[model samples]
Target: MINRRTFTALMAGTLAASGKSFAETARGKTVFYASVGTELFLYDVDAEAAALTRRSSVMLPAGVQYAWPHPSKRFFYVASSNGQPGGGAVNQGDKHYASAFRVDPATGALTPHGQTLALTARPIHISIDGGGGFAMIAYNDPSNLTVYRINADGTLGALVQQRAKPDIGIYSHQIRTTPSNKTAILVCRGNNPADGKGEDPGSLKVFGFNEGQLTNLASYAPGNGYGFGPRHLDFHPTLPFVYVSLERQNKLYTYGLQLDGTLSRDPLFMKDSLGEPNNRRAGQGAGTIHVHPNGRFVYQANRNSAVVDFQGKKVFAGGENNMAVWSIDQKTGEPTLIQTADGHANQLRTFGIDPSGRMLVAASISPILMREGNNVANLSAGLTVYRIGGDGKLSFVRKYDVDTSKGTQFWSGMVSLG
Candidate 1:
């Protein structure tokens, strides 16, 4: 028997099958996309079945580092570079850029839309404002931020110049604007502890937003930002709270949003993201984070894809590789860990939940050699899909493997058909 959500999807598919224009399709239908190196792969997502079918792929100028969909849902911005992961350059030339693509409403096919803007450095993160009028980008190496105007034709325009400020924190990981479009926050994941080096402090740099111009507001951190390494953050859909993922410490923190466009000086709540918090392990850190669209749950990725040499063979270092599901207390904005679903693959770098809050897709970036008993083999990169339950839990549905020998699967996201 077809349930309500499935029934709605069937009706929408039926209308599209009956020759309805692609633009006329229901806006609730969703499709997923992943960036594997310089290639972009599109998928048709089934919300009820929690499945994905590969559609096609498109090529970009260089390797994809990050991507952001416009608020209009009709366009997407992709940042590409030749730089490889870790502390070195790939020497593919410094031809880094941010390109725009047109989204085909029905099939999720992408076509180049406008001129690709040359970027000064690799963009660690990029996001469009709530109003879809500006594209805000964050760079990591020598941290900086820039805002570009979204042209009337859905293209990108020149950068909006602003006064130089010394408050931009180190290693900016993500940048996002508030729903109210009055504030912008940059998540800076300061350096981790290294040999003969002390750990660098991290903080959330807040700015006052006015038509893409950012004015320094405040930097919120605990104990002068020491021992705090925030990588990503997501705002509640309806509440004045924010969920942040701490990369270096493998924890989650919640902050209250003040009306003056600043965050609480200290976290209102702090929770461990690991399944076994007491049993410490090496090569464990938090990745991307997303709040459920309905504001009832929060999800974060726990990754451990690093390998260690065992008996002269490079084998997977055992660590948690799963999605941590946390139930949100709507009244107070606190989160409780409810479930940790195995992501099937290692190192889930990024993931996305559908706008309707019914489906989730996770992308595992790279493959590593795993030891199964005495035999060892390479685990391929893949994407996992799950169905979100009413209680804010996740039920694993299926996994789609992709050959990452050519390039890594850096990022993936679900875009609703407009």
Candidate 2:
């Protein structure tokens, strides 16, 4: 078998003959990465055919939770841990780390780049600043945030001391830097009431960032965050609007980005993410949100993977598992629901859109047995591809079934080479 070093060198040699940097020749190429346990697999994307072909893989130190590509597209930062969520546990596993990898621009193969940094808790989400000078990580167990400086050579650097300890709200789910790179936002998805506990309020923690140091700026919590729980947010490509996916309410909220690097006090628009808004289900929730590269359309995932006891075994519970499409009014920055495309999988935890805006790939976490009129069918975990039409609607293309017996398909995304 060809070793990783040899394979990387061979791939690099193929492009060296062209006498062009990876950034110069990467205009039309799109690479997709998906993680199963600690292994991250790279795939070549055929946008025209809406398909993916596996190319190579690399192993991380622990189960991969999330990853972000550097602004130069020459590196990737990955957060991983053996920790599992549930039962109010602070951290179920002892191992947590942040690792850096050099991205082989020619083939998108990942090679270890630097020493792994040990973390105190499992990192739920991670992102890099627009300038690629820092890595922002968010932890949910105790709801905290940390910023680390990225070295000039793309290696992981020391953690930057904060100007002040910002009040990170409960259950932080996602964190992102503004397009301007002057501010950061931490999405706190508070816990829903369960057992004998009361509901925890959720809020968006805003911070002023300067050279990796963060200062508390503002917190947005409507109605004291009782009915609001945002899981993710994406900024419009050219507009000042930010779209957020509400995990607990199954809704979408559009907020205005202010000049001071903070959000408006109230949402400009709040719409139900579900097609049948009135017919609610117990397990339905919004997963991730993304804006099309063209800036005219938005997409969100409606996920449901709750299980029920069936024949003395856990089986899939009925609910919507689909992608929600919206057409954005360019002038007003408003979105109108256009279509709800069937996901054909159980839980669509993550998805990616090619930089060219021609295709989409959604990943379901694991396999599930479904009841269809008393007969059960096993739906395998998969990467489902869809074609994006001119009108901004998704057409089902195909799916690649993934074997997840050893681990779950935790995270997946597309990275366009610089």
Candidate 3:
């Protein structure tokens, strides 16, 4: 068995030998961004201290849904829309856009790079291929995917029309390209049965990709995807393993990443994500899953924002709202639950880990009121920071409360400074 020090050294050496340009640029500084409504704010991160200092800000055309950085670390892509949840007459809104930004390597500031591409619907997630040649966007309402070329100058190019109508399952949440850049996976989180509606099965849509064009390859939906609702997935850094966060079931699934970019038909292992595995409640779900840079650990967010009417006011319905930490077995790629650290807020919609894997910052979407004995206390939306230990555990460091009156703290993530 490899020791912690030896494993870390090996991972570092492998990264150096790979000579990834982003790693070279990220050697010294780390920056973070958080979006509230149409404005995106930047922060400087001190990983050792587990603190964040607000820096600059930029505005998007609408509320920011998600963002991804180019492999070169010189550009960033953002998706924005005026749409709100609950599809039908509940305000679908009209405007949707995908914008590109040029990253200032030295200061980690952003400026508009290319013309914004108008999207047909609100983009739920956006990702760039490993080669940084194309940007893939996923829409939820109609469940669709779009590919746009990334210009040499790091600008958004025209959409690449696909001749194959791949089956994009219900409520697509995320789209990502495989490490080989030869295939892509779309995470479709089918809706759970509600209001006399039947359960819409979820699926992982795999496609063969070439020159920004995608062809249908495979769709993996165990048990016809009745109770499976995967929100996000992350690949192991050095192992042929993929970890998926099941949003609806509050579970973590491990799958083998095949040579051809398809996943194993059945999960290799599955584990409960919640600390109280038996106490499942409405609105209790998993948000994101990410593997540590050293490949020794995986982290996921468990969120619960369910509310109940009490004394003519909405009050927090207690449930799990924290980060679930898992220790990965290096040899077999199995994960064991180790810790469930408190998030200290409601609706942890997103979070980011520093490139060095020394710190993690989670963002809560909005404030919530919880009944404490006879009185109610307000839990404000904020950015919670934690210090990562050598054993892949997290220690609570500090939290910076954010003002979300203007809009929810919708999205936040870390980006290595180039």
The lDDT leader among the candidates is 3
Best by TM-score: 3
lDDT score at residue 148, model 3, on the 0-100 scale: 96
- Cα-based TM-score, every candidate: 0.91, 0.93, 0.94
The sequence of per-residue lDDT tens digits that candidate 3 reaches over residues 70-114 is: 988899999999987656546567999999999998878999997
Question: Which should have the higher TM-score, number 1 or number 2?
Answer: 2
Shift in Å, residue 248, candidate 1:
0.6
Candidate 3: TM-score? 0.94
Residue by residue across 1-418, what tens digits does model 1's lDDT show?
Answer: 2235543453343333234333343346688899888999998887777888898988999889888888778999998887655432444347779999998988889999989999988788899987799999888876788999999889999899887563679788899987567889999988877878887789999999888889988898786778899999998765677899999888999987766657887898999999988864788899999988777899999998667887688898898899999999866788999998998998999999877788899999988889988888878789988999999888888888888888899989888777
* Candidate 1 vs. true structure, TM-score: 0.91
Cα displacement (angstroms), candidate 1, residue 386, comes to 1.4
Cα lDDT tens digits, model 2, 62-124, are 999999999888999999989875524754588999999998878898999989999999898
Off by over 4 Å in 1: 1-27, 88-93
Question: Cα lDDT for residue 120, model 3?
Answer: 90
Clashing pairs in 1: none
Any runs in candidate 3 off by more than 4 Å, and if so which?
1-26
Q: Give every collision pair in model 2.
A: none
**What global local distance difference test value does model 1 have?**
0.84
